[model samples]
Structure formats: structure tokens, C-alpha cells
Target: MRITEVEIHEFDYEVARTGTVGGNWVYDPDSTLEPPGFVLTIRTADGTEGHYRGFAFTPPMIAQVTMVAEEHLLGRDPLERRGIWQDCWRALRHTDHFGLGAIDVALWDLAGRHYGESVSGLLGGYRDTLPTYASTMFVDDSGGLDGPDAFADYAETCLDRGYDGFKFHGHPDVRPDVDIAICEALAERVGDEMALMIDSSSLYRTYADALRVGRALDDLEFFWYEDPMHDGGVSERTTKQLATTLDTPMLGLEHVRTGPYGTVDSLAGESTDLVRASAHMDGGITGALKTADAAEAFGTDVELLLGGPAHMHLMSALRNSSFFEHGLLNPESTWILNQGFEGEPESIDDDGRMAVPDGAGLGVEIDWAFVERRRTGHTLID
Candidate 1:
């Protein structure tokens, strides 16, 4: 079967539990948000179609699908994704190729459906369940995850609920003093029973602040320190220095848009102790798989950022990866990840582990009725 058409649907969705907090998604009741959601469909001439529900971005991905890839994908073999991925990768060069994942993932879905296997199985997966960590939103003042005591109390609550690890986004403004205090308090409370981490989100104003917090984390024995520098993790000199200075492993490159190619720099520079890959941010599952393989070759661990079924499928086959980010959660609120389908925390059981979907492809069914009711824009390319 040959490629015939591609379609993109933009829709509206809102949730009380999940909203932007200092660049990280969090469960917050004080914030009411209507973030746009996207879904892409690619159909062959014979009527088989594959789908991808987008997370993390809306417009660039939409533009990449509707504008850049409109005429480029017609009449090609739908299952031969490598060359198609390369074409879009070059086409989107000016914009970091942000929306290639939408195309690449849909093709993977098509392949899985054709082969009668899950996406993980297509990648030769072995494990069925993934251990989880409660990744938190940025520090807040509106009565949730606000201060040291609030964070400590929440960490203990997660531990009681069977979580294996906990991670929190520091203040969006990057307060080293306040961040250190929360780390110390959490260490006193449940650091030994559960692994701990802090994501600075690249908000630190000065290298000194990152150093101070990194020194504190070294003492607390946190699992990892993520994106601590204000330089946006592009400064190889600073990242390498920080990695050597701190005993806590540094997880960097969340902002890097070069796919797996640039990751080779971080590995050679010895800047990052752990690698960051995302199906959304990193080209697609195909690119993320390359990233994971590159990390494994260097004997480093790779972590998938955010939570979603695409990420779950990729991580299931990775031997060097750890933890499904079951996050941006608020214990007192509903965890609405996306509007069209079920996300993590809901799939996570009492044991704090999530099983890979045994069905073919991404193993997700979209709520088309919900999409129709909230439809915003639709594009068709044939």
C-alpha cells in the first residue's frame, strides 16, 4: 500500500490538575487552562490508517504536519519510515524539526497494526512493567507544593501510595536558598526510603546558584540533578564543569533539538551523566531509539521526559532507562494529561508500576466524540 493522505485535528481541552508551573506541568487547582491538543492521521491507498496524539506542543507540530509535509509524503511507501523521517528532518531544519515525531510515530502505529504487534514489540521489547516516579510541578505558593513542609508532606504521601521515586521542579525564578531548604527537609523526611531529584528547569540566574544547589544535592544524595544551568544546557564548558563538580549525576539536553547527533557531543564532552530523550522532542520513536542506543553504547542511563504512551513504548525496550515519569501530579486533584486518551498515574497501579499496553501499535483509542465536540481546526493533505 502507498501513502495517500495525512490529516491533522486541533481541539481544545482543559483540566484542573494539569497546567503549566514554572515550565513544568503540575496538578494545580488555582490555574484553569485550555491548552490545545492535536491528533494526526496517515492513511494508505487501501484504507489502513495510523494515528498519533500529540503532547507538549501544538502549533509547530501542526505546521510541520500541514504546511511542510503536505506534498512531500504523497505516494511514498507508508511503512518505509526511515527515508520519510529524514525528509521531514531536513524540511524542518529551521524550526528544530519539531513536528517530525507526529509523522514518525503515526508510521510506527501503521507498522504495528500491519504486523499485529505493539510498538514496543516492534522494537523488540522484553519488559512489560515500568517503575514510576512522581515528578512534580514548579514550586508554588497557592496552597500546593508551596514550601518545604508541603513538599515533604507530599513526598511522604507519594511513598505511602507506592511510588519508588520523587522529583520536583524548583522555583521558576530559581531560588537556591529555598530549593536547598526543601531538599534538606525532604531528605530528613523520606530520602532514604525513596529516591529524590530536583529539576532546576534552567531558571537559575547564575552559575553560583546552580553550584550551591548542586553542592546541597551532593550531600542529600539525590538521584539526579536536571537542567540546572541558566545557559539552557547548551554550554558544554559549564555542563562538563558542573558534572565534575557535583557527585549527583547531571541530566541535561532537554532543550537540545539536534536529535541523536548532538547527543554525541554531550557524551564526548562528558558533560552529562545521564541522557534525556523524548518521543515528542526527539524526532520521534525512531530518533529516540537512536538516542537510547547511543546512551547505552557509552554505558550511561537515558531517561524519557514527561509521560505518555509513546514514551512508555520506547522506554519498555530500553535496558539502560529507568522510571516512567508519572507526573505533574497533585494528590488533591485529577491528573488530566491529555483530552483524547488516558495517560499515566491512571494506568499506574497501587504498586506504582505501569504495564505496557499489550495491543498493537500505541495501544490507545482516541475519544473521537470529544474531539468533534471541541474541534478547533482540521487539515488534510493528499
Candidate 2:
């Protein structure tokens, strides 16, 4: 189907809980909790739509994305996902790649709608159920919880809930040694029961600092590290340094956008063990799929991160997939708002795994009225 129109929506969602890591602090010292997230939605000409939930983006970022989409994707085939993505990248490279992802996701959502297939089907098909890991974000203002206790409690909860593994996002301002000690306790408490990982979230300011932490975690035998540093801004020399010094894999670059025609290397080279590919944030289905392959070429795996039905839909389809990143975000809005799987996946599984929705494309078709009811502003090209 030829594309007729593209629509984007920026809406506000509630935040029931807030999380803190040692390196990055989202918890306002003066506040009670973290702020709600910003979500985006895309609609195509044929009337099909897709959903994207992420951090509240700035006006300039949103505008930059819309401008690129308008210039390059007004009347293209919704199914020629890749070609259309290339057009956006080439057209918008002048603006420093501006949210190249938002536009790509719009197109992919359009394609899934057109094919009447789940976003996962568009990628290589995989097991219906995959393992899920719990990512806890806690802002411990009360100080009642320590790193080890926090990790143990969360990991045990994941085990009780049937999840296969668990990850803890450390308090941004907390000491690295404190965070490491927490990981140590978590490893000891549930090592045999489940896999464990830690998110430094750019806690280490220098490559050596990161290396020291990575080596410590390696001794702990954790799965892999998450976002030890930021994207291209993180020095390649540093990446090489960390890579050589640490046995554990480094994971990140979640902020890169999907290409109308660009590759992962075009954005960031293979410096990590795992790259986060959000179908919604990475240009929807089309751009995400290609990037998954590129990640594999660089010997990196794809961690399908973030919220929404679209994420589960994409995870179900990826061949070289990692775990479904399950976090309890605004459950009051998302789960209460969603007509799909009620509340999160049933549990991890008997095999210590979790699966995707068994239904058709995207599995869950969200109610647009619910979205429109909460609509804050337009993100699409009219």
C-alpha cells in the first residue's frame, strides 16, 4: 500500500514508581518520585497505526523528526520499509541524525498494519515464549534498602514471578564499590536459580573506572553489562580499553535511530556485546530489523528494550534476540489502558522463560480512542 499520511502523537503517561542508579539520578532529591514518561504514536495513510512509549522528548527533537518524515516519506510504499528508512537518514543527516528513529518506526508500524502481520513476523520468527528479565529502578530516599538487599529482593521476586533472569539498575550517585557489593550478594543469593546482570548506566566517568568495575563484575560472573557508557560520545579507544580489560560484554547505544537506509556502523561501530534495538524507537519494524542483523555482524546481540505491545511483537520475531526487557512502568495507565495481556506476561515460565503474544501482527491492537482521549498534541504530518 502506498503511504498517504503520517501521524505522530506525543502524550503524557503516569509514573507510579521512580528508580535511581549510582551514576545517574532521576530522583529529584526534593521530590517523592520520578516523572511520567512521554509516548509517541504513528498512523499511516491506510488508517493502520503503531504505538511507541519512551522518555518525553524535547520539542526540538520532535520537530526535527517530523520535518524529516515530511520531506522524505509522504507517498512511499509502506512495505518498502528499508528503502523508506534510507531516504529519511540521507535526507536528515544534516541535522546530526535528529530522532531518525521516530520516523522509521512510523513507517514500520504502517508496514505491519498493511501486511496484517505482527511486527515480530516481519523479523525472523522465533519461539513464541522467550525469557524475560526484571529491570528495577528504585530511588531509595528512605535508605532502608542497601544494594545487596535490593538486588536480592528483586531477584527473588523475579524468581517467584517465574522470570528467568534479573538486572538491577544501580543508584547513579551511589559508590561503585557499593554497587559491586550489591551485585556480589545478588550473585550469591540467586546464582543457581537465575542469570543476573547489572546496569552501570554510565556510572563510571573514565574508561579505567569502567574497567575496574567490569573486571569486578567479571569476577562475579554476571551475564553482560548494560550502558556502561553513552553512545558514539564514548571514546572508541575507551571502548577498546574496556573491552580488552573486561571479560564481561559491554552493552549500549540504545539511543541510535533506525535508518531509512543506514547501518548500525553508520551510527556506531561494533564496540559492544549487545545493542538495544527498540522497534518503536529504532524506526519501528523496518529499521529495527536491519539493525538487528547489523548488530549480529558486529558480533553483538540485540536487546529488545522498552514498553508497549509493539516491543513484544518485535521480540517474538527476532532470530538473534536477547531477553524481553520487562519493567513495571505506569501499570495504572498501560495495563489498565491496554485491552491486551492484562498485566505483564503471566510469569517467566517452567523453563525459566517468557514468551510473546501468540496472536497476529503486533498481537495486541491498541484502542486508538484511548490514545486520542489522552492526546496532548500532534506528532504526525497532517
Candidate 3:
């Protein structure tokens, strides 16, 4: 089917209470500005349409992307999805193409709809139900020290609901001490009954700091350490520290871009464990698949991060794919209003597993009413 129209939807929700911290490494908010959420809609000539969502962006950015892509996509074949992904990415390299991940997701969904197949099948189907883990970010007003208690509460809730594993945001300012405490408490609370992971979000500030945190988590038998340091320069250093200093595996590459592969090669030099591939951020299915292959050459395993349901489809099918990052707080209320599966922790299986959408093309249905209700200004393109 050919693309008849493309529409971009931007929405906002009143910030009720900001309990969780920002995913960005450097975060300092005086409690004034609210975060934005963006979602996109693409319609094909045959009357089939697809929807995809993303977090932490402004309406102007979403509008800017829609303006650039509407011209490129409108008379093209919706089935030619990979080509659509490449062209859009190549054209937007000079202007923060990372923000364009939502478009890549929309294109994949479009192709799935046109071919009447699940996105997972296209990604090379492996299993229907992929085990998932809870990643928690709840913190009390005390800043960071309250994390351990909040984590304990959250973990227990997930466990009660049937989840097998859970992860917590481990960082310094958020309570470096609390990070240690939570890992220790979690190990004690669940023991081998659940798998545990810690995401530092590169909050350690220095490589040495990351090393200390990694060692602590390793002692606690934590699964992996995420983004201990954001800079590529220290990636190998940090990975080596984790491998040697601590047995904890380093998991990241979520915000990584496609490039010379030098950093990835260095990290895999008996230092790193898994390269976290975010299909949304790293281009799309085609680009992500390429990244996965490159990691294989270096003997680094690919652990895909499912930012949401759309990515979950691909992660379920990926052979080398590991687990997904499930957001605890609704960064963007409108982003998931219409998609299947409520944001409730229970949507994930008791064993922390997810079943691939069995129906055609991502197996997700859009709730236009929800979309229209949240629409800020632009109309849903027919």
C-alpha cells in the first residue's frame, strides 16, 4: 500500500508530582518546567494506519519532524519501510536525528500493517513470551536516600503481582548510600526468587565512581550496571573495571548512535558484557539489526531495550535480544493512552515475561478517541 498521509500528534499532561528523576545524566530542575511526550500517526493509501510513541520532547520538535518527513513519505510505498527509515535518517543527520526514532517506529508499524504480519516475525521470531523485569525510579522527597524504601515497596508490589525480576535506578546524588542499601535489601528480600539489576544512568560522575558502584552491585549479585558513565571516552575503562573489579555486567548503548564502531570494539575487548541496542534511538529495525551484527563480530552480545510496546515486539523476536527497560513513571501520559496494555506493572507477566503481539503488525490497536482527546492543536490527518 502507498502512503497517503502522515500526521504528528503532540500532547501534554499537568505535572502532578515529580517523584522520579530524569533519564538524562545531568538533571537539575527547580520544579517549574514539565516534560513533554510525543506520538505520531501515519496513514497509507489503502486506508491502513499505524501509531508510535516516544517520551521527553517538545511539540515544536515533533512538528519539525512531521514537516520534514511528510514531504518524504507521502506518495511512497508503505511496504518500503526500511528505505523510508534510511532516507529520513540520512536527511536529518545535521539536526539531531536521535529525536526521529518515533518516525522509525511508525514506519515499521506501517510495514507490518501492510504485509499483515507481526513486527516480531519480521525481526526473526524467537519466542512469543519474553521475560521482563521491573525498572523502578520512585524516590521520596528527601532526594535520594528514600529510594531504598520506595524500591522495597515497589519490588514487593511487582513480586506480589507475579514479576520475577526488578531493576532500580542506582546513582550517587539520588542517594549513593541508598543505592547500596537497596541492592543489599533486594538481595535479602527476594534472594534467588527474583533476578535483580541496577541502572546508574551514568550518575557516578567519574569512572572511578562507576567502578565503586559496579563493585558494590556485583557483590550483591546484581545482573548488570547501566550507563555508569555516559561519555564514550571512558566506556572501555568503565567496562574493564566492571569485568575485572566487579563481576557485574555493564549494559548500555541505549542512547548510542551509528558510527565508526571503534568504541563498541574497544568495549568488547574482554571488558564489556552486553551492548544495549535501542531500536528507536539507533535508527530502526534495519539499522538496529546492523548494530546487532556488528556487536556479534566483536563477540559482544546484543541486549535490546524495549522503550515501550513497539520495541517490545522486535525484542521478542530478536535471537540475541535480552530484556527490556520498562518505565515506572508515565513520562508522557498521552504517549500510551491508546495502545494496548495499561501502564500498570501487572501488564508484565508474573515471571517478568512479555508475549509477542500475535496479530498482524505489532498487534496493537490505536484508540483514536484517546489520541483525539489528548491532541493539543493539530488534527489527526485523514
Candidate 4:
């Protein structure tokens, strides 16, 4: 079927907080926060519509979506996913092409609906459930995860909840010694019962700092060391050096572009022991699958970043990958975004495994009323 129209809806959602300690999208220390979310609907002439939601949209990202919808996606066949993906890739080659991913994802959702299947099934379903880890929020000084003992206590709570693994989103102060102390404390608390990992979020300022922290992780027998030093995990030589220096596997390239091509280059350079794939960041499902397959070819696992319906599908299908990240989680905040769902809002089972939605497409049924109430603006291209 051919596409007849595209609609973009921008909305605001209240978040407990609006900044990340490090990695991509780190907010300024004093920046005023007005977080934005968007939903794009591609409606076909025959009345088949594909819907996709994107969180944390910048002004440029919103503009890119509008441009792509008006110029490239208005009348194309929704079934021509690969061709559409390639066209969008070329259309915005000069830029990182952030908005292309949302459109590509919506197209995949449409494809799944048209075929009466789930996206995971379309991508070759491997499993129905995935073990998940408790990925914590950045350490705060506000009496919530403020210190090492607090983190260890939280780890114990997660273990009691049935999580097989836990990951710390360390403090943003770039203190390697503090990070090491936290790691050691966590190991002492629940290392025997849970596999632990850490995402420094690129906080460490120097190779020496990262090396020192890496050695501590090696001693604690942590699962992986992620985005350890600065340079935003983009320096192949430096990452390679870190990987060679540490026994703990380095998971890098979470912020790189070009999906599989960039991942393959890093692999060839021996920069990372493992690769990272995110459907949202890596050109939607198409690019993420390419990265996963490339990682497979190299005899390594691809840890898909973030948590969502799309990530659950990828994790279910990929054999090399392990543990879904139930992230940015904290005691005071709720991760639930959508309301009026039948099962648990977060998609996590009582056994600590993430369950794939069995419904068609992404398998998520949105509460349109809730979304409409939150709408700040809308744009329609016909």
C-alpha cells in the first residue's frame, strides 16, 4: 500500500529529572529543562496506520522529522522499508540523521501490522523472554543513592526482586576512586548473588583514571566496563588501549554513528570487547539488526542499549546478547510512560525477565486519550 499522509504529534511529559551524568545528551549543569516527547503516525490510503513514539526530542530533531515526512515519506510504499531507509540515509547524509530512525521504526510497525505479526517474528524470533538487569539512575546527593552503601542496599533489593544482574550509573564527578569504592562495596554486598556491571557514562577524565577503575572492576569480577573514559567512547585507539589494559570486557561505541559500519570498524581496531546496539539510535530495527549480525560474525555479543518494545524484540531474537536493561530506574521515580495496559506497565515479569508483547506490530496498545491530553502541538503532511 502507498502512504497518503504523515502526522507528527509533539507533547510534554513530566519527568522526575531531566539530565544525564554523562554519555550522549548530557544536560548543562544549570540548563532549564522542558523535556519533550513526540509521536509520529503514518496513515496509508487503505487506512493502515503505523505509530511510533520518541522521547527527548530537540528542536532540530523535530524539524528533521517534518522535513523527511514532507519531502521523502509522503507518498512512498510503506512496504519498501529497506529502500526507504536507504533514501532517508542519503537524504540526510551530511548529518547524523536522528529523525530517520523514528520513521523507519514506524514503517516496521506498519509492516508487522500488515503481515499480522510482531516485529520480533518479522526479524526471526529466537525467544519469547529475556533476562533483565536493574540499570540504576545516576548517583545523587539528595539522600537517594548518594553513596556506596546506598548502592549496595539497592543492589540487594534488586536481587531480592529476582534480577540476575545489576548495573550502576555512577556519579558524574569524574572521581575514579569513588567509582572503585562503589564497585567494591557492591561486590561485597551482592556479587555472589548477582552479576554486576558499571556504565561510567564517560565520566573518567584520563586513561590513568579509567585504568585504575578498570583494574578494580577486574578484581571485583564485574561483567563489563562501559563508556569508561571521555571522548564519548569514540576514540578507537584509546578504547583499544583500555580494552588491552583491562581484563573486564569493554562495551563501547554506544554513541557512534553509521550503525554496523562504525561498529565493524571499532571491532577491527580491537577497540571494544563487545558492541552496543539500540534500535532508537542505530537507524531503527534495520541498522540494529545489521550491528547484531556484524557482532555475531566477529564472535562477540552486541548489548542492545535502552529498554523498550523494540529492544525487547531485538534481545529476544539475538543469541549473542544478554540481559535487557530496565534503566534510569530509581526509588523515587516511576518508569511507566503509557497507561491503560493490561499487564505490568514496565513490561517486566515477576521472574525478572522482560516479556515480549504478543500483539501485532510493536505489540503496544496506546492510550490515545492519555496521549492526546499531553499533546503540546501537532503537524500533518498530506
TM-score of each: 0.96, 0.80, 0.82, 0.93
lDDT of 3 by residue, 1-382 (tens): 6777767666554343343445432112333233555567778766787767655445545754665665667788777766776787777776655645666777778777777888887777778777677665444444432546656666777777666678776653545666778888888887577788877765666666667677788788887777667573245655666666677777765555642253366555655667766656666566666667777777666766545656677666566666665654322212222242333322556456665666777677654565566667564443
Per-residue accuracy of model 1 over 1-382 as CA lDDT, tens digit each = 8888888888977766555755565556667777788889989988888888875678888877776565668898888899888888888888887788888989999888888899999998888889989987788766778889999999999999888999988876667898999999999999999999998988897888899999999999999999998888999899999999999999999988888898988998899999898888788999999999999999999999887778888888999998889777776655546568754323677787877887888888777888888899998888
The TM-score obtained by model 2 is 0.80
Model 4, span 1-382: residue lDDT tens: 8999998877766544335444322223343334677777888999998877776444556677777776688789998988988888778777777777788888888888999999889988888888999988777665667779989998998988889899987777676777788899999999998989999987788888889899999999999999987788888899999999899999998777678888999998899999898777678888888889999999999998877777877777898998888876776654434432334535567787888877788888655675688778888889
RMSD of each: 1.7, 4.3, 4.3, 2.7
Instruction: Name the lDDT value of residue 374 in candidate 3.
Output: 64
Candidate 4 has its poorest 10 consecutive residues by lDDT at 23-32
TM-score for candidate 3, residues paired by index:
0.82
Report the alpha-carbon TM-score of model 4 versus the true structure: 0.93
Scored by lDDT, the top model is: 1
lDDT scores for all predictions?
0.84, 0.59, 0.62, 0.80
Between the candidate structures 1 and 4, which one is better when assessed by lDDT? 1
- Give the Å shift of residue 347 in candidate 1: 2.0
Q: Judge candidate 4 at residue 236 and give its lDDT.
A: 84
**Candidate 2 per-residue C-alpha lDDT over 1-382 given as tens digits, one digit per residue, 9 for 90 to 100:** 5555655554544433334344233423333432333344555555766544444343545766667655566666656666766776577666645465655555555556667765567665666777787765532444423457756875786688777777776655646777778888888889888778777765566665566678888998888887675433245556655665688877766544433233465335545566776655555555666677786676567787655565666667667776877664211112222322234433456665655655544555444564466557774465
lDDT of 1 at 18: 50
